[model samples]
Target: QQQVKQSPQSLIVQKGGISIINCAYENTAFDYFPWYQQFPGKGPALLIAIRPDVSEKKEGRFTISFNKSAKQFSLHIMDSQPGDSATYFCAASKRTDYKLSFGAGTTVTVRA
Candidate 1:
């Protein structure tokens, strides 16, 4: 079984709109949750991350909402611009584990 699940394989948003992506995981051992964004040519880069201690986190236009009991998380982009369009992935890792399990990626497009 896949440890993590993601929804809406693809999304399209207008300029200055909000874009959202969701993720769910089955592993209770997971202690770290991170989101990654990737452009066409470059490698995926860490966008934002959250520990179960906090329910939510926000940085600039990016936000990560996490639910520990529910084993779920979500990413939201505010005022999404064309440059924000990219593939986003949600991942989970345990404190002692070196490997990270990633949910299927979501491809977002911001229309100019």
Candidate 2:
């Protein structure tokens, strides 16, 4: 298992709303989990992440829920705003490898 897959390649959320997306993975060897947020053309920026050791991790408007046994994870956006609109990606890798295997990518739209 060496791949992570995400769905709803695009999403739409209203301001003050919540956006939820899901992802699945095949590799159980991954040791680190990271999420990236990207703008129109900029490189993905590290958002929030969670390791298998933890069930959930939250930071500001973002949260990551991890299900180690299922090899699944998810991202939740609270108080979604227009400014939150962007592309989100989920990735995983081992501590030895910095190269992140990312999902297909999800585009979120938060209307004002």
Candidate 3:
């Protein structure tokens, strides 16, 4: 069963603009939040992640903004490029369970 919900099934963004994807979950037991990026015919790769203890985490041009109380989180891609075009997935998992529940992916297309 899917425990995480994501919005904007697809997105088109101009180069150098910001691309954002949001996700929400109902499970309070979730402690690990991860975002994965995948290209055509390729498996998803872990892009970034956050824990309930932190409100936000950033690496390079990617950022994950988390809301613990609201059970929501978001991914922000700054200066989006054509190479960034891919399907992104938001997932949640509990530390003890070690099983992830993923949201429907959002395909992002960056326009040059």
User: lDDT of each structure?
Assistant: 0.94, 0.91, 0.96
TM-scores across all candidates? 0.97, 0.95, 0.98
Q: State which candidate, 2 or 3, has the greater TM-score.
A: 3
Which digits, one per residue and each the tens of the lDDT, describe model 2 over residues 1-112? 4399898889998899999988899888897889999999799999998889999999998999999999999999999989899999999998789688999999999989
- The deviation in Å at residue 82 for candidate 1 is 0.3
Give the poorly placed runs of model 3, Cα more than 4 Å off.
none
Candidate 1: tens digits of C-alpha lDDT, residues 12-108: 9999999999999998989999999999999999999999999999999999999888889999999999999999999999978999899899999
lDDT per residue as tens, model 3, 1-112: 6799998999999999999999999999899999999999999999998999989999999999998888999999999999999999999999888588999999999999
Pairs that collide in candidate 1 are: none
TM-score of 2: 0.95
Per-residue lDDT of 47 in model 1 = 94
Error of 3 at 65 (Å): 0.3
Q: For model 2, what is the alpha-carbon lDDT of residue 93?
A: 90
* Candidate 3 structure, TM-score to reference: 0.98
After the best TM-score superposition of candidate 1, give how far the Cα of residue 109 lies from its true spot, in angstroms: 0.0
Query: Candidates sorted by TM-score, descending order?
Result: 3, 1, 2
